[model samples]
Target: MPTDATAASTEEAATRVVAFFETLAPADVAALGRLYAVDARFKDPFNEVQGVPAIERIFGHMFEALDQPRFVVTGRVVQGPQCFLTWEFLFAFRNFDKGVTQTVRGASHLVFDDQGLVTLHRDYWDAAEELYEKLPLVGGLMRWLKKRANS
Candidate 1:
């Protein structure tokens, strides 16, 4: 069980992470160094990177690939130095979807250091269902497969 002080600290760190991701921008990529430790590790469905520079590059590529991509933290739970956050990542594909807004529901598990900087950040989401299933031709196949599996 976490003490009151430990819970408070975890909540504060979680809040900062939510705030940072909500306000993420190309210009703000460099500021990630402040939120993450120098040797921080980050992993997601499509990326596994360590260190601030690598993490920065991953976010930078997101801006390059999608238009107006942003993360909205919907819920949060804190435990000691660890936090879990549920979020919706919203974006519009510049090339394919055009102006259509795409939403990917996901969660993140974060571990923060004593100094409050994130040491490990891992995102949990379904690539096939959340992403690949949203594509054009692949979407139809993916839906069919899901239906068949369910039935």
Candidate 2:
């Protein structure tokens, strides 16, 4: 059973997390240091960054790739110390125009502190299918490979 305080804290943390991502345009990710605990652990398909310093580097790289990026979190379910968040990211490569928006749907398991700051954030998604294979040249190569392997 979850205490009311826990639920409130998580809800608040969720809001902050969502806001943090919404403002994120590669550059805004630096503010993540303020939201994440000093010893925060963040993971995704491409990299696993531990602590704020490493995390900042990862965000820097991501920002360099996508200048204007936004994350839309549609659903959040809380259970005790954990929150399951479903989000969709809208972004485009630097070379791509503003009208070209790619959406990546995924979920996160977030654990928050008493102060509603993120202590651990883990994301689950397949980059091959949701991202890499969606690119122009890379996507064509991947599709060809898949066709050859399947046939």
Candidate 3:
């Protein structure tokens, strides 16, 4: 059982995380230190990094590769120092999809430190389905593979 204070802290943490991602930008990379611990570790399908600088680099690459990328947190579950968030990441490939928004549905598992800064962040998503399948050449191959697997 969690006390009222604990529940409030968890809610606040979840809200803060969602707000941070909602407006995340290349310039906001520096703010990672505020939301994450100095030794925070972040892992996703495309990146595995430790520390704020490395995490910032991964987000920086997002801006460089995509246009108008944004994250919308659809759901959040928090218990104690851990939180899980279901989200849709919207973006457009700069060279490929151009202005068309592509949505990647994913979830993030986060562990926070005593100070309420995230200590570990892991993102879960299907790379082939959510990302590679959106590409012109790879999309066909991925679809074929998925169809074959389903049969």
In terms of lDDT, the best-performing candidate is 1
Candidate 2 per-residue lDDT over residues 27-50, each given as its tens digit: 676788778888989998878877
**Stretches of candidate 2 exceeding 4 Å from the true structure:** 96-99, 145-151
lDDT of 3 by residue, 1-151 (tens): 7667776786787789899999998889888888999999999998898999999999988888889999999999988788999999999888886899999999999988767889999999999999989999899999999999999
- Off by more than 4 A, model 1: none
**Candidates' lDDT values, in order?**
0.93, 0.81, 0.91
Backbone clash total for model 2 is 1
Q: Candidate 3 at residue 85, lDDT?
A: 97
lDDT of 1 by residue, 41-103 (tens): 999988999999999999999999999999999999889999999999999998797999999
- 1 against 3, candidate with superior lDDT: 1
> How large an RMSD does model 2 have?
2.3
Off by over 4 Å in 3: 1-3
TM-scores of the models, in the order given:
0.95, 0.85, 0.95
Error of 2 at 65 (Å): 1.2
lDDT of 1: 0.93
Question: Arrange candidates by lDDT, highest first: which order?
Answer: 1, 3, 2
